[model samples]
Target: MLDGLNLEVPQGQIISLLGPSGCGKSTLLRVVAGLTPAKHGTVSIHGEDVSQARSRLAFVFQEAALLPWRTVWQNVRLPFEIRNQKSRKTIESALKHCLEIVGFQPNDWHKKPSQLSGGMKMRASIARALITDPEILLLDEPFAALDDMLRSRLNDLLLRIVAESQRTMLFVTHNIGEAVYLSQSIAIMSRGRIAELVEVPFTYPRSSELRSAPEFAAFYGRVSEALYRSER
Candidate 1:
């Protein structure tokens, strides 16, 4: 249902799509992830069409959706289970690095999803996404299910991960505060199209303190204005 939607996400930046529910936010992420093919338009990653560039992308959904039968280590290693060309050492190294990036402790590795807290499960999900070391990461409200405090903690963790990896990211979220806190720019969508894009003129290392800053309020107002206008 995307209507002539055209967006250019810059390299190595976190850009968020903010819109009401069912306004094609998730649809847009799915399209970009190559999960849902676009019939009329082309999706290109790094100048190559999706079909040719899919290997360079990774996606994380709101729900961790880990297999109930798998342990944390097994869940994070799920992507590698499908391919067998890699040596055990290489796979172990990749899993170790991705797990550390998402702050997974060694003790938590053998635990099942039912044994882990909600946040821990999502952390495992993120580790699974990062194990591939994708160039472009597409997230569809990955932290939306968590409570406010947990969500903020995860947001900080995500920012650290993004800064460390420097991967290009396209994040979809309905939370204005999250969009403002996490993205360098916010694309406001309404009625199946992008209504506007607003740049958040803030530097990196932004914390919860930024939420109380005057500049943060100004940017929030600007994005809110765009969102309000989109529904008109």
Candidate 2:
């Protein structure tokens, strides 16, 4: 039920969608991911429409969504198996790099999802998303289920990954601070449309200490105000 929504994310930058519940944030992500169809409008990535750009994108859901029976390695390798775009040797090589990027130790690779902690499961999910080497990454509240400390840690991990990979990302979150901390810009949505786009003035490689700074608090307040106005 989106209403004339349009957004343009710069190459290699992260854009977060922040809003109240049922404002179509998750639905927007789904539309861009091509999981949900739009009645009108076109989604373009890297100058190509979504259908043409599908192979260059990857998505990470709120839940890890790893198969219960699969080991960590198996879960991360699932994309390659489904796509059949790479040879076994190539996939094995890529799997090693992806797992290492997400901070999975060699020993933990054989463990099933039930044996892993929530954070570990998310790491596996991110690893799975990275396996495809996508140009754009779409995330739907990927950290909502984790505790504060763990979420902060993974936030740092995600920033590091983005720095190294330079992938464009669209992240959806209800937390103002998290949205401010992670995105280059925040798009505040209301009633199925973008109400405001706020630029984050801080440079990247932002540490957790940034969250404690006065400037960060000011920006967070600004975003919160924007959200409040949107809802009203």
Which candidate achieves the best lDDT against the true structure? 2
Candidate 1's error at 48, in angstroms? 0.8
Every model's Cα RMSD, please? 1.0, 0.9
**Cα lDDT of model 2 by residue, 1-232, tens digit:** 8989999999999999999989999999999999899999988876788987888899999999999999999999999989986687899999999999999999999999999999999999999999999989999999999999999999898899899989999999999989999999999999999999999999988999999999999988889999999998
lDDT per residue as tens, model 1, 57-121? 88998999899999999988888887553688988998888888888899989999999898999
Off-target runs (Cα >4 Å) in candidate 2 are none
- Candidate 2 — worst ten consecutive residues by lDDT sum? 44-53
Candidate 1 — which residues are off by over 4 angstroms? Answer: none
**Per-candidate total of colliding backbone pairs:** 0, 0
Question: What is the C-alpha local distance difference test score of candidate 2?
Answer: 0.94
